[model samples]
Target: MRVVVVPPVPALLSRYASLTDPVPELRAACVSAVAWLVEHDDARIVAADDQARRIGEELLAQGLAGRVASASERIETRIETGNILVMANGSARRSEKAPGHLDERSFGFDSEVEAALAAGDAAALGGLDARLGAELLASGIGALATLADLTVTRAVMDYADDPFGVRYWVVRWECAS
Candidate 1:
């Protein structure tokens, strides 16, 4: 199974298009990852909330050329496990100019998450501190927690950044399901 973890930032969606892409690199990573997920046509999105869900759907539409899948519709098309698109992000307070302002604790938290993704360690990802994540304005700690069930055999991160003080990661994992 293929599992992809991407930030839920709305700026990546076409609806939120600006004069110039605010997150050009992030958008590129997200689009490429989504394209990879849709190659098998078994992408299932796991979002933290309504906003995350929207971003996932928008990404799917972009990947599939406007062919977006509803949750029920996607389930009906497959009986076995398939690709996973996890909409989550780390702390948004990496610097003084960050959305949540500078929080020294964010570095530790984001580093732990980055390490887990780089190592494909689900156990470490499962143990993340949601309370601290919330205090630091992490977008999808719950969604990241849900991904603990995945048994990854290999992991590759295509992008990692905190451009707007929000920690975003685009990671792909090969899982043994």
Candidate 2:
């Protein structure tokens, strides 16, 4: 099975579009990821909340546009029925400009999550402190926690950053059944 995780950043939605894109790199990552998933395989979306779900679905729909954007820059793969799309994010308070404001703890919490994503450490993801994650304004950590059940064989971190005080990641995982 293939497992992928991406944050549901509000700016990615079409409703929020502007003349100049605020999240070009992030949007590119999301589109390429979803395109890869839908090219030959259907997917299941897992999100901790409604917004995440909506965003995930939208991204999925975008894949139907049948545009890969670039042949060399994005992934190319045959797909199957076992692809998973997870909507998740780290703290919303990585800095003072963060929506939740700088809480200091956000740094550590985000770091742990980032590490788990980069390494495909499902155990570490499951071990994340739920209370602390909540306090730090982490989005979709619940969905991420659920990923512990999967036995991952490999992981690739496509993107990682805390733009606008919100830590987001684009990750792909190959899992063993």
Candidate 3:
């Protein structure tokens, strides 16, 4: 079954980055956030079918207990039939029916995904992973030891044209269990 799975917002990591200046914390957040993506089979939330939605919800449930975003950031998760979309905006909206261009203002998952794909740099993924990992640690989730344990499964490009301006990449990571 096909699914449109939106990646989770690494709320914990983002908040931690603002509160602290430690590099290890940032790296941990990066690993944890990307590792979560790996478990989902390198999914980029564009749309979803019935089976996909169910699967997405089950996966997201695992991370609910460890939310790391601040009050203002306010991350949100929702499942619709076969479409699972997670965002920090607290609003639910389907991808454009006709498939239009993605604006730079499109939000977290899409923007990052787009930029990552455009850069086509493996190093960029690692860099972002490091940054996110550090952010997560600052948020007080776990140590770098945990993030380092994650395994990156696969990386793929879900490409589309953007009318906005700059292109982006959406790198996926699979962690070691």
Global fold similarity of model 1 (TM-score) = 0.90
Using Cα atoms with residue i matched to residue i, what is each candidate's TM-score against the true structure? 0.90, 0.89, 0.23
The model with the greater lDDT, 1 or 3, is: 1
Top of the candidates by TM-score: 1
Could you tell which candidate, 1 or 2, scores higher by lDDT? 1
lDDT of 2 at 106: 88
Clashing pairs in 1: none
Q: Tens digits of per-residue lDDT for model 3 on 1-177?
A: 122212222322334344554434323433444345433333323322444333333334433324433311221322222221221111112134312323223345334434543343323333344333232221111211222223334434332332222221223332234
Candidate 1 lDDT by residue in tens digits, 110-153: 99999998899988878999999899989788778877878999
**lDDT winner:** 1
- List, in order, the clash count of every candidate structure: 0, 0, 39
Off by over 4 Å in 3: 1-150, 168-172
lDDT of model 3 at residue 17?
49
Q: Give the Å error, residue 113, model 1.
A: 0.5
